[model samples]
Each structure stands twice: as C-alpha cells, then as structure tokens.
Target: MKEQLVFATNNPHKIEEIRRQLGDRYTFRSLQDIGCTEDIPETETTLEGNARLKARHVKSNYGQDCFSEDSGLEVAALGNAPGVDTAHYAGPQRDAEENNTKLLSELGDRKDRLARFRTVICLIQGDTETLFEGVCEGRIATSPVGHGGFGYDPVFVPTEGDGRTFAQMKQDEKVRISHRGRAIAKLQEYLKSRSGADRPTG
Candidate 1:
C-alpha cells in the first residue's frame, strides 16, 4: 500500500504543488483533509525551524507522517530584513500586497537588488525527520511582475532562463525551477530510492 502523508499546511496551492511533485509515489493530503483546523504558532526564528515545527506538530498530533515547508525571500540590499519573517513582514494578518509594499519601501534608493528565495522542507515520520533546502538567486524588481504567482513572486526576477519573473512562468515551469521545487525534487529522489521499502513503525 502507498504511504499516506499529511502536508502540514492549510494552503491549497502548496498542497497541490507538493502533490504534483510527488505524483503516485506517495499519497499526500493537507491539514484540511485531515481535519486539522487549529492554528499553530510560527514563532521560530529560522525557516528550517518553522518547517520542522509544522511537520512535527501534525506528526505528533495526528500520529501520521507529515510534511511541511517554510519559504522566504531574502533581499541582500535590505540586510535580509524579511528572510524568516516573510509572512509577517507587514503585520500578522497582512496579505501579499502589504508585505511587498513594506519590502519595497525598506529597499528605497538601494540600487543593488540582489536577492534569493529559499525554501526548507521537513518530512517527519514517527520520530524521524528529514530536511531539504533549495535556493534561487534573483534581483528584486522596482515593481511587481506578472500576476500569476502568489506572495513575493511578482517582485523577483530570477538569474537564469526567463527574463520574466516567476509570476509569469507556468505552474509546471515554476515547479521545475522554484526553490520549493528543487527541495522537493531532492525528497522525491530519496523516496524514489526507498519506494518499495516499508515505513518504519512505532
């Protein structure tokens, strides 16, 4: 039987991305499907810490394998001001536009727009935890780019391939080169190698 994994997030987009990446190798479900409605604190100071915390929470609470990811945009010009605090850069409940505005305002007059997006993924099964990370270097645009992607996608242009930002890329294209995509690819490789192996029992 295929292993059932819970993605420790309420974001449908993220869950869909993960599902597409993993395909038939694993059956993945999100917090909503698992009836996890409780909001968890993301008070960690680092991306990896936050990813691990979310995965650990679902694994412990639901007694099932869980996966989680924490991603951020680090602008070199702003001293990485929004690295781990990407979600709350403006305020606890602010949306993407507000967060992007805050970031742009902080980057005033700074000509060096070098920045990178990082994603840390954590996979927890029982007491075992595995971590994977990926990064995409780019520069922050003076204004938003295409309107396709969410969060900070519109304001960042990658260092390779496309002249347009991530927001302009198709979903499959984005998944192929995105930081989260790269990280999840590593996990997929790991799982592919252990495809037929049995999951460790408690």
Candidate 2:
C-alpha cells in the first residue's frame, strides 16, 4: 500500500500540480480531504516561513504527515517587490488578473524584465521537519500570454524554455522546469530515501 500523505493546501492548481508530480509513489490528500476549512495563518514574511507555517498547522491540527509549499514571483526590476506578497500583490482579494495588471503597470516600459519564480516546500513527518527550495530564473512578459496556468504563469517566461510564457506550455512541459517542479523533485528524492531506510532487512 502506498503511504498516505497530506498536502496542506486548498488551491486546486497547487493540489493538481503536486499530485501529478508525486501521485505515483504516495496517496495524496488535500486540506479539504481532512476537513480543515479554516483559513490557515500565513503571516510569515518569507516564503520558507509561510510554507513551514502551513505544514506545521496541518501536522499539529490533523496529526498527519504533510507538506506545504509557498511560491512567489520576484522581479529584479521591481526589487522583488512582491516576493512574499505575490498572492496579494494587487490587494487582499488574491485576484490573479488584477495582480498581473498591477505588475505590468508598475513595470511599464522598463527594459529590465529579469525575474525568477521561487518555491519553498516544508514537509513535516512526526516531529521531523524538512525544507526544500527551487528557483527558476526568467523574465516577466510585458503582457499576459497563454491561459494554461494559474497565477503568474501567464506573464512568466522561464529561462530554460523558449520565449513562450509558462501558460503557453503543456502541463508536463512546464512542470519539468518549474520552480515547484524542482522542489518537488528534491522532495521525492528525500521521501524515497526515507522509504528505503524504513524498509525491513531482507
């Protein structure tokens, strides 16, 4: 039987991405699956802190071994203005379109479009906590491109890919190079090692 693992998130996009990446090895459950309806606190000022906060909340309240991730788009020209505030950059509504518009408006006519997407994952199992981080360097597009992804995907073009924005790429294509993907890869490695170590002697 696959080891059951909880992912502490209510966002379907995040849940889908993580499930696609790690579903083969483990049984995945979301916050709703465990009946966590309250909005978990995310008052952390840093990506890692926020991720840790969510993971700890689930583990403490639900007594489940779970993981949580926080992602942000940091634009160099903006001095990473929305590093920790990526979700609510425009306002507290967390509207992606509004956030994108605000980002573009603030970045109008700027030549420097260098940016990066960063993801931090915090995993809690029993009393042990582990963190993993991944970064994808890229540039912010002047306008939204495709509609394949959520949040900043429509305006983010990864350095590892062609000029197309993340939203223009297929799900598998994007996942292979996304910051979240890289972090998930590291998590899979760690989970594999843990599984191996927990196995009984032959």
Candidate 3:
C-alpha cells in the first residue's frame, strides 16, 4: 500500500472517518497537511467530475498521489434538487441546518420520502484516475432523529437498517455501510493489489 496519500478535503470529520477505516496501513493526509488550502473551483456538473477535478488539482499542485470525493443527498421527490450542490444547497453561504431545513420544506406534502446519499471517490496519480462509487438508499424522516453524525445523517434512515437514522448509529456501525465506507473499501482493494512506495507511476 502507498505509505502516504493525500485526500483533497478540509473536513476533519471526513478525514477522521477515512483514517479510521483505512487505519495505519496507509497514512491519510489532507489539504492542510500538504499546504493546499487554496480554493479549487468545483465547476463540474457531476459528482465524478467534481471529485476528479479536486484530485487532479491536488496532484498537479502537490505532485503526489492524491484522492478526493464529492458526495450529495438526492431526494427523489425533490427531483434531486441537491445533487452536486449538496454542500451549497442552502445558498452561497452553506449551513447544514439551513440545507436540511430547506430539504424538509421542499419535501413537504410528498408521501414518498425516497432519497439516497451518493458518494464518488477519485483516486489519482498523474494522469491515471480510478473511480469508486457508493449509494445508500433511504428515506427522509419527518424530523431529525439523532445527534451523532453530521450533515443529513439525522434525517437519513437507511432502507436496509432497523429504521434508525445514521446519526443514531455508532461510528463503527455507520462505517460498515455508509457511502464513504463502501468507497473506502474499494480503494483499499486497489491499494492492496498494488502495494509499493510512493513513486511516480507512468
């Protein structure tokens, strides 16, 4: 496995989660550790595009093996209103509470609360990029349920689970099937098959 890999993100929660999943087998560093706090425009129209855009930017800027992810909460009733713009759904200045509230408001009067959390992770080394995707199907609860996870976790009740919101599940429990977890699993498989020092690959 690569000794050190960069994840192009600034969210500590996300970094912690990924580290917990990947563990000491590989060191996971973020934008701050690599001195890349500059704004990278997410001008892409799809999750895969945004993820690759971030990963490519980090690879070019830091000249290292970098990975990035773009995730979104898409509600079937809302016509996927917050797809790629999930982070900024509430407006230019995004707030989790605002975004969640807006989602609930828009979903009002709709009996079908179908929704899915989609995540796309892009692993990049120079011009080579590999994509892994995961989706968790669930329904939006009438109101927030727990205080554990972040973002829309409080309202997302997984279809395969015991009706508990993701925020209500323990970190380990959530990591078992969360979109990020699945993506990380795929990445681990790739790394295990190609274990080596961090050298430039043509």
Candidate 4:
C-alpha cells in the first residue's frame, strides 16, 4: 500500500505541479480531499512560518501526516515588499493579474529587475517536523509573457533559462528548476530515506 500523506492546499495548480514531480511513490490528499473546507489562516509573516503553520493545522485538526509549502517572488527594486504577501499583493481578493500589474507598476522603469522565487516546505509526521527550502534566481519581465503557469510565473524569468517566463516553458521543463520543484526534491529525498528505514529487512 502506498503511504498516504496530506497536502495542505486546495489550489489545483500547486497540487498538480507537486504530483507530477513526486510521481506515484506516495498518495497525496489535499485539504479538500480530507473534507477541510475552512479557509486556513496563514497569519505568519514569513514563508517558512506559513508553511509550518498550515502543516501543523492539518496534522492537529485532522490527525494526519501532512506537508505544506509557501512560495513568494522577492524583487530587488521593490525591496522585496511583497515577500509574505505575494498572493494578496494587490488586495485581499488574491487576483494574480492584479498582483502582477501592481508589481510592474511599482517597478516602473527600474533598471534593476533582479528577483527570485523562493519556496519553503514544512512536513509534519508522528511528532517530527522538517523544513526544506528552494530558491530560483531570476528577473521580472516587463509584462506578462505567457498563459501557462499560475501566479507570478508569467512575469518571472529564471536566470538559467532561455529568457522565457516560467509560464512559457513546458511543465517538465519548469518543474526541473522551479523553486517548488527544488524544495519538493529535498522533501522527496527525505521521504525516501525514511521509507527505506521503515521497511522490514530480511
């Protein structure tokens, strides 16, 4: 039987991305899958804190092993103003387009387009907690470039890529170097080690 783990999120995009990266090694259950309908509060001021907060909430409330991640786009010109508030950068509505627009507007005509996407993941299991972090150095585009990725993907270009926004790249391509992908990779490594140790040896 596959190990069942809960992912503390209802966003289909994030779920899909993570599932693709991790493959079939383990079964994942989203917040909705576990019948959690309440809007979980992310009152923390940092990405790592928010990830831990969500994971803890799910583990405590539902009595399940779970993991949660929080990602943000930190721009140099803006002094990383929208670090923790990446989702609701524009308003409380959490509109991606509005957030992108506000980001561009605030960074108007600024030569320094340096930015980076950061992801922090928190995993909770059986009284043990672990955290993993990933970062993708890049720059913000002058305008939205593609229609593929969610959130700031359309406006952010990875430094190692061919100058295309993440939204413009294929799913597999993006996952290989994305902030979430890197963080998930670390989590995957840790889980694999744990699974191996838990197995009965001959």
Per-model root-mean-square deviation over C-alphas: 2.9, 0.9, 3.1, 0.8
Clashing residue pairs in candidate 2 (N, C-alpha, C atoms within 3 angstroms): none
Candidate 4: which stretches are off by over 4 Å?
A: none
For model 2, the stretches where C-alpha displacement exceeds 4 angstroms are none
In angstroms, how far off is 144's CA in candidate 1?
0.6
Displacement of residue 141 (Cα, Å) in model 2 is: 0.7
Clashes of each: 0, 0, 1, 0
Clashes of 4: 0
**What do the candidate models score in CA lDDT, each in turn?**
0.85, 0.93, 0.89, 0.94
lDDT of 1 by residue, 1-202 (tens): 7877787888877878878887876777778888888998888999999999998888888887878999999998788869889988999894999998988889876899999999999988667799999898888888887988788888888897477888888888888888989999998887676664755656
Q: Which digits, one per residue and each the tens of the lDDT, describe model 4 over residues 27-117? A: 8899999999999989999999999999999988899889999999899888887999999999999999999999999999998999999
Tens digits of per-residue lDDT, candidate 3, 1-202, equal 5588888999988998999999887787889999997989999999999999999998887897899999999899888869999988998787888888988888886899999999999998667899999888899999888999898898899987899999999999998889888888999888877665455577
TM-score of each: 0.92, 0.97, 0.93, 0.98
Rank by TM-score (best first): 4, 2, 3, 1
Model 1, stretches more than 4 Å misplaced? 196-202
lDDT of 2 by residue, 20-88 (tens): 988677888889999999998789999999999999898888888899999999999899979999999
Task: For candidate 1, give the lDDT.
Answer: 0.85
The Cα error of candidate 4 at residue 80, in Å, is 1.3
